[model samples]
Target: MRRFAAAFAAMLATCPGLVHAAQPCLTAAEASSLTAYALPSAITGTAKRCVPNLGTNAFLPTGGAELAARYAVRKHQNWPAAKAAFLKMGAKDESSAFLANMPDPSLQQMLDALIEGMVAQQIPLDRCAEIDRVVGLLAPLPAQNTAELLAVMFGLAGKTGKAKNDLFSICES
Candidate 1:
């Protein structure tokens, strides 16, 4: 999970205009929805990008497809709120006009591609083994549980002053 969090934080840091200190925050549910929708693809992309490092027998190379598939089942179900939460994270006044004017389908496509590309690029090869181990540990949990756990951990980080550099905030419940 540390690997996941570190990779996510690195990805967020590279995104321009995401540090909107005063932007409207996502609700806990919205945050969870976004995490649920995005996490599977992130993992899948990481696994694919790290295949050379992970080896054929690594859990990610062997079981990642199944794990990602399990999480994908709820992606459509989570999209609406996830989309809103994603927009909230990215949109920053006139700078985000391009995002605001894009149609939903186009926006979603861009977001999906961006997630895959960013995960593939951000995760360090040196950490692939640790990431593979962490994801394998997480694989036994239900998809929702994994997503919710991540959301809660992020939310707690924001709330407890641990997330000083987080890109966006979670709203108070």
Candidate 2:
């Protein structure tokens, strides 16, 4: 009985603990499951039935990547031009103007949760290739791009925050 108790204790000690509780980073499968529901359009009534037009630069995370390849396409285009591209994909409308240069607080947290969840689940974005393209874009954007975009979404770092350069750090641990 003592041996069994020791073994039981050992097993308990060996259990994965909080380490297992930590979620995996975003991946392709998880992204697919939430794609239809967790979109910005789903959250914002303004974009009903329409993919949120992320302007030319509003993509990467919120819209789920696939833009790098489209970079060449985007180089020849602008905000209105990007909107036209979304239209070709059966997208009908957009949420707002070029949030690319703007930011909102509440929306930013919501977006951050979505992104953190994605990275945790290893889930891809709305599309597989899109995630790839977005990573490519963000990888080069001074590391703070993601954090800045998050602040913009949250309305924290926009015209109000005044911490333009530091916005990238976002206090990410």
Winning model by lDDT:
1
Clashes of each: 0, 27
Model 1 weakest lDDT span, ten residues long: 1-10
lDDT of 2 at 33: 22
**Candidate 2, residues 1-173: lDDT per residue as tens digits?**
11111222232223223112222222222222222222221222211211233343444334333332322232222333322322222212233333222344443344334333333233322433453354445544432233334333322332345533211111222
Q: Each prediction's TM-score against the native?
A: 0.83, 0.21
Q: Which candidate is the best by TM-score?
A: 1
The Cα error of candidate 2 at residue 41, in Å, is: 26
Instruction: List, residue by residue over 49-82, the lDDT tens digit for candidate 1.
Output: 7877877898998999899899989988898888
Model 2 CA deviation exceeding 4 Å by range: 1-126, 154-173
